[model samples]
Target: MNLFSEIRSLVLDALAAMQAEGTLPEGLSFDNVAVEPPRDAAHGDMATNAAMVLAKPAKMKPRDIAEALAAKLAGDDRITGAEVAGPGFLNLRLSATVWQGVLAAVLDQGTAFGKSDMGQNRKVNVEYVSANPTGPLHVGHTRGAVFGDALASLLDYAGYDVTREYYINDGGAQVDVLARSVYLRYLEAHGQEVAFVDGTYPGDYLVPVGQALKDKVGDAYLNQPEDVWLADVREYATEAMMDLIRADLAQLGIKMDKFFSEKSLYGTGLIEAALKSLDDKGLIYEGVLEPPKGKKPEDWEPREQTLFKSTEHGDDVDRPVKKSDGGWTYFAPDIAYHYDKVSRGFDELIDVFGADHGGYVKRMKAAVSALSGGTVPLDIKLTQLVKLWKDGEPFKMSKRAGTFITLRDVVDQVGPDVTRFVMLTRKNDASLDFDFDKVLEQSRENPVFYVQYAHARVMSVLRRAAEAGIAADEATLKSADLSKVNHEAELVVAKKLAEWPRLVETAARTNEPHRVAFYLYELAGDFHALWNRGNELTELRFIQDGDAATSQAKMALAQSVAVVISAGLGILGVNPAQEMR
Candidate 1:
């Protein structure tokens, strides 16, 4: 039951009636008409911009259209009052029974109250956490992981067919370095001392991998040169590192639907096929690129390379597909990967990258556009850095990871629920500070704690009702006489509940999951305010003394708050707390 949408429908019907009666001109489009919450709650329950948008098209004054529309709306039972404000805007006041009906609908639907079908079941692939498969995931990957996972869940709730994917960066020089690093560890396992040079990994996490390799092939490649052992060791070390990364993701309750290997695109003719598709459209050419913008002329040298006409789509300059040495550039493989996705029959593609990859956004979008012939759209979201703090000071690096803090380092300090919730408190492109001490504090300043406490408080009310011999189950609450729940304070919470369905569609359309966290916080604040007011006024309490009928009416509102919070937390992949510890 979306009250805003329902009211907008009513306003549209009124405009149609006015057109038929010649009160307003015909052939005016109502697509821009919108009904939303008023900025000042004291003004009215809802506001509409129908008059302002239709005035110029109908060749009529805005105030004249607003007055006619207000009279038509006043005839309906749902709208008790409609007044013209600021010459064109219409402020509407709904009856108390309408807000009460919203609470009853919450009880009827439970956690499924705000689900939407706006996506129309379109196939969408969300690829994230595509870090190099050379080591365990670090703090930067953690932010991208949480944001992407939450977004996938949000799209699913909005009725999209979503596939969560991870692209393994195994076909790069870093994996070669990992192979040599494991070889050093294997030599150490055989009682030989080896020093880690500047190119090899020095983290202690590889000790076990080295031991495992020695157990598999005993003294076979012990003294062999690079050619004899490099290929085998590269395959073995990449598998080991991927296993570590999988475990790190499991720590946060994340399980991807697919893990695409970059090495699979090599020597498989996929790169040639993707480039051929572009070449057939006359987008591929050989040209000499200009020197970089900030480079000195003496330090620059021009060379002929294979280039793609990326500027034709939207990129600032044409991008290189192959280097001068006849080898494919890094962007070549990425193009092939997206072509593979398009061939798999996906309607849309979304890439979640780190903030440092901002330079690749325009080129990547251009490639997908040219490959799909502008039929499919690609959206790229970049997650900013996460700065960790301990005891009001900067946190130190992890010993296991050698230089940066690993994902497990953050998850272990505070459990996965807190880590996931705090990561989404800010926008994906905004920096976040995760303070170990402040997040764990049981205070209102902590958003996770505040939101959790609201759910826990509702549970406490249910328990108290049970002890007092009052029936407060969902079935009983759904059948309660909600007409008695007409207090202004109680109605305020119901009004907020009416916004959930609308909020879900807005957040999903914008691809912003942080808006869900923000809405949950605001709903919690409204609920907490009513709870505090009940202390001074006994009639506002959930359990009225000696009156089970009125008590059930008030308890229904509190229970509805918990239902929405649980749904919101489910979208964020955080478990709703039943009780505070």
Candidate 2:
């Protein structure tokens, strides 16, 4: 069903035939040979660089090789014309029947038209939005959550066994800080006036957590010492914050398959086991790290410590596993967590982190490399900041979150569909501006609206056809005589539909889901362009006047566009609009 792939196979077969006929030398590698859309559509429908790539190896002139290859390709029924361009490039035009088949395939496959088997069922662990369980998730974590969830869906569509995971940062001193903050709130719940200190959380979201603690144990830990209440409150407050986070994610249609607790790695010998694996490979050592570049810290001193030889595995410097006080460093638990993932036999690992954690990428990759003995590969994607604008100014901070806007703040303003679609409108590493006024605007400049409007337009067409008593169901569309869809403007849409399977493979391979959004926009533009043309050109309209056979043929083309849009939107975790209000 992939027209590009089928054409590439045909080109390769032609080259093999040329070799047999002595038009070219034997045994030239075709790995680099590519068939793709030409840079200038005016030149042809597709272009191939086979002659240009094989010229030096085969000891033949590129123009000569291209001429021979063109003759061999002209014998095929699919290719209408193959002409040699500058130097050795071959520009090809496919027959109209090829595009007709592409439209027919769309009706046959529906949303499954572009699903790929490139992954071959390899297990991949994608860990994202591993924010600290201190409060509800903020805007930065929202971007990571959307990106990670969409990536997991894209991988699944590409045939990978993907696991959506969240690593909870609950083992560090932050949880103790949360416990103290909740204790202050607990005192307030007990009718005692309390002021939140600079180090404690002051968000009103904790007010309920404090009341829940009071409801569970009435007056038991009242005015108690730190040792008596800190442990119990830390556990209770962590679970409460996680519940809030889960609710926030649900507001955006994100659900993780696993929520790994950082506390589980401690007191479980897992940390020691991960380090021992590194030690067995001579990657662990007792050494002193050089002071960081630039002005040194006031407390900087040469202290021998347990370190990992991360430099050998691509890190800029060796990292410490233990601090001078003999406690595990912050990076120790992360190492153990990744090591546990590798031990689970996943073939690949992906981590989605906020832009501020760009510095942690090399060290984390080094840890996984050492732990897996260079078997499992890790890719860390950093989602940049989101600037929210409203009423021609910056959006104010959420009163509930105290310092930043919560995920619920964004989702509540615009529903989950708009929020999810707009979050992926930009690349992950690029900064994005989520403008409240602009996103809600129903115009072509808004990608989410443009794509959704196209789907809605197709639904309108189906409804009109149904009222007109024209049978345009799936069965009729698949069996329609698509030869009537012969106009160049209509063929442009079919050509774009033909690119869906290829687009899915490219986006999945590069781990970029924004490309799906980008492609949907382009496809919508082409379909809208054709739709506008039908106003003046009576013959180009979908429902031909009293011609049922011709109308079903053109309706099939419009429905096929909707099919691909639904498939693309599905990968992005956005619902196709049955009708745009």
Candidate 3:
């Protein structure tokens, strides 16, 4: 059970009882009622805004309402004390038994302790890592992959029906470039030397695709015209590139529920259908766009084109659907793609894009809003750039600079778990520095190591307890005399454990996976603080000679920390480390 939510229910019940007894006004709104840990531990265990929210509505003084509510709450067996503080705020100190119950609850639930039903089983489609299928994924795409995957797992824990999707950008001119690049490799596979020209991809990863093509077709299109080879080679190259992408994602432990192909929109009437839907809504119109405001290009001219009236929804201006040349603009198929998603009846859509695409967020949201009539909400998460560091120096990579680092470059140096966790150590909108040396460092300063060590410490305690002939299993430890856990340091951990369910719900509601990472860090810090404090005071230690019950009680507390750490790491898609080495 969620202790916070459980206590919140008690507060609500007391409020309802007040209304029944005419102590409070009838039909007063209590929508803002919340039970959460106070900002300072000295204040109390939990605080609520019930008095302040009901003040104006009940036509009573907030302090007066708070005083009445305090008396009502103090009567509950779980709340040891409830008092009105400054400005009518009510702080309730829960009995130690309630915090003790959290440990028992964690042992009972194991990794499932903090799982929530906040999502209501609604279908949510999280589409991320929509990188161009030209080569192996680079560092930028790796961050997006980790963010989206962790978010999907977090949503699943919060009870949403989450579908992890990847939109492949294979229909664009980029794939044509990929085809020519592979054709050059195809020529090389026939034992002919080829130089990667200015327009072709030069990554060594494509060399294998070239060799594979030669093995399959035996240079059938060697020295032939583009017409003779372009079609077959484009299909072959995209498949090969996707295979490489799949392997790269596998390295990071990301598995997509579906890979939506952009090429499939061509000649399928999907673009036409999507545009027609907008046309019927009067959102599509023919217009001449103004020359961009600040800087007009040398070729700038007013031209009539098919435009989506996105401003009607939320965008700053209407956007082009078909270019002046009468060809569908790049955004035309994208609108159709999202329209297809909306029609498929997903409750929500989330797009994880690179931070450089920040300009595109408004229009995308506008399209989904127009298509779904605001019934389906769309959240676009822009992941900022990852700056790689090595040997205390900034590492720069760009294909143009001939220094671009691929996803494999990062994964090969550091294992997938370290790579994934380090990628999420910062918020998606914040620039992240991924250092080969820092992420792999075995110290408390590294968040990955710190959290892992907390888990490992608990396991060590379990082993020690086992060797001492004490059963450290959940049944025995949970049944031990938990009254021995009276120290403030030990109870601080229980307080952190009490916030798990609430943390899961909040993080999932905001589509934030980094919050889980931050929570684990805080929880790990609390456990470590308590563990170190035990060094200064022997009674705080987990193992006590000639005292099986107290030892079992402290071991139970240690196991509870591991349970939460495992659950949190599970959401992050990181395996819990049984040992640091």
Candidate 4:
């Protein structure tokens, strides 16, 4: 049970009683009323602004409304004290039994303690790491991949029907470049020296693709020009690059539900259909765009082009759909892709992009809004850049990737668990500095280590309790007499556990998975604090001398902490460590 929600219901009931008795107005709205933990624990256990929100509408003084509401709240069995604080704020102190109930709920529910139904099984499409199939994924794509994967998992945990998707960028000029590069490698595999000039890929990772090409079509395209083999080579090279990309994502345990090809939008009338929908809505026209604001390009000139009225939706300017030469602009395909997503009957869509794509956010959101006719909402999350440091210096690029560190390189040095957890230590919009030495160090400063250490400590307690022949399993712990867990130090942990359900709903509502990582760290801190107190107070120890009943009560609390930690880590795609080693 969510204690906060339960208490909020109590407050609402009291307000309803006030209205029925004519002490308050009949039609006042209570939608804005909130019950949450007090900012300062010394103030009370919980605080509410119900009186403050209702006073103006009731034509009454704030303090008068607060005092009346406080009296009604104090009559509840769970509320030990309710005091009217500064400016109609109500601070409530709950009995120890209230916090004790939190522990019981956690034990009874196990890892399902904080699961929420906020999503209501709404279908959400999360598209991320749509990196071009030109090479192995780099550090930037790695961040997007981890963020999107964890977010999908979090949505699923909160009861959303989530579809993980990737958009393959193979229909653009880049794939042609990849084909020519692979063709050069094919020549090199035939014992011919080929120089990779300005526009060709020079990475050694493509050597295998070239060798495979030669083995399949030996001497067929040798000494031939670009026309006869360009089409076949382009298709072959894209599939090979996608194979490499799949392997890279597999290393990090990311599996996509769908890989939508950009090529499919071409020759399939999808792009035309998307633009025609806009035209039917009076959103498409032929026009000349104003010159860009700052630092206009050297070849900048305005020409009449087919444009979409993106500004009518939300974008800063109307965006071009087709260039003057009758070729579709880059924005056209993007609009078509989002149109296709909306047509799939999704309730919501989210795109995880790199920070460099910040300028595209507004136009993309506008496209989705216009295409969906305001029915489907779209959220675009941009993951900032990650700087890698090692031995107190910036890490150099990988030789295999030629220009950047490959995702495999990072995952190889540190395991996938470390990489995933550390990547989420910061929000998606903030830049992160990843220090190899610091992350691997077993210290409290490292969040991954600190959280795992807390879980291990609880595991250690469970093992010792099992050795002592106490029934410490979940079934026994759920029914344990928790009256012995009335100490102030012990109650602090119970209070933190009580916040899990509220946190799950908040994080899911905001589309922020990093909040889960942050909450886990705070919960671990509280658990460790209780464990440290046992060092000084012998009675506070989890295991008491010849007190099996009391020892089981404390073990129940310890097990609850583990259950919540495992649940939180599971949402983040992290494995809770049973032991630090």
How many residue pairs clash in each candidate at the backbone level? 0, 0, 0, 0
lDDT of 3 by residue, 492-534 (tens): 9999999999999999989989999999999999999999999
Pairs in clash, predicted candidate 1: none
Better of 1 and 4 by TM-score: 1
Q: What C-alpha lDDT, on a 0 to 100 scale, does residue 118 get in candidate 4?
A: 84
> What C-alpha lDDT do the candidate models reach, one value each?
0.94, 0.94, 0.91, 0.93
Model 3 regions lying over 4 Å from their true place: 296-299, 396-403
User: Using Cα atoms with residue i matched to residue i, what is each candidate's TM-score against the true structure?
Assistant: 0.99, 0.98, 0.97, 0.98
The digit string of per-residue lDDT tens for model 1 on 1-581 reads 77788999999999999999999888999999999999999889999999999999998899999999999999999899999999799999999989999998899999999998889999999999999988999999999999999999999999999999999988889999999999999999888999999689999999999999999998888999989999999999999999999999999888999999999999999999999999999999999998889999999999999999999999999999999999999999999999999999899999999999999999999999999999889999999999999987899999998889999999999999999999999999999999999999998899999999999999999999999999999899999999999999999999999999999989999899999999999999999999999999998999998999999999999999999999999999999999999
Question: Distance (Å) between predicted and true CA of 237, model 4?
Answer: 1.7
Least accurate stretch of 10 residues (summed lDDT) in model 3? 395-404
lDDT for each residue of candidate 4 in 250-307, tens digit (9 for 90 to 100): 9989999999999999999999999999999999999998888884667578799999
Better of 3 and 4 by TM-score: 4
What CA RMSD would you report for each candidate? Answer: 1.0, 1.1, 1.7, 1.3
Candidate 2 on 40-75: residue-level lDDT in tens?
Answer: 988988999999999999998999999999999999
Error of 1 at 168 (Å): 0.6
Error of 2 at 433 (Å): 0.5
**Ranking of candidates on TM-score, top first:** 1, 2, 4, 3
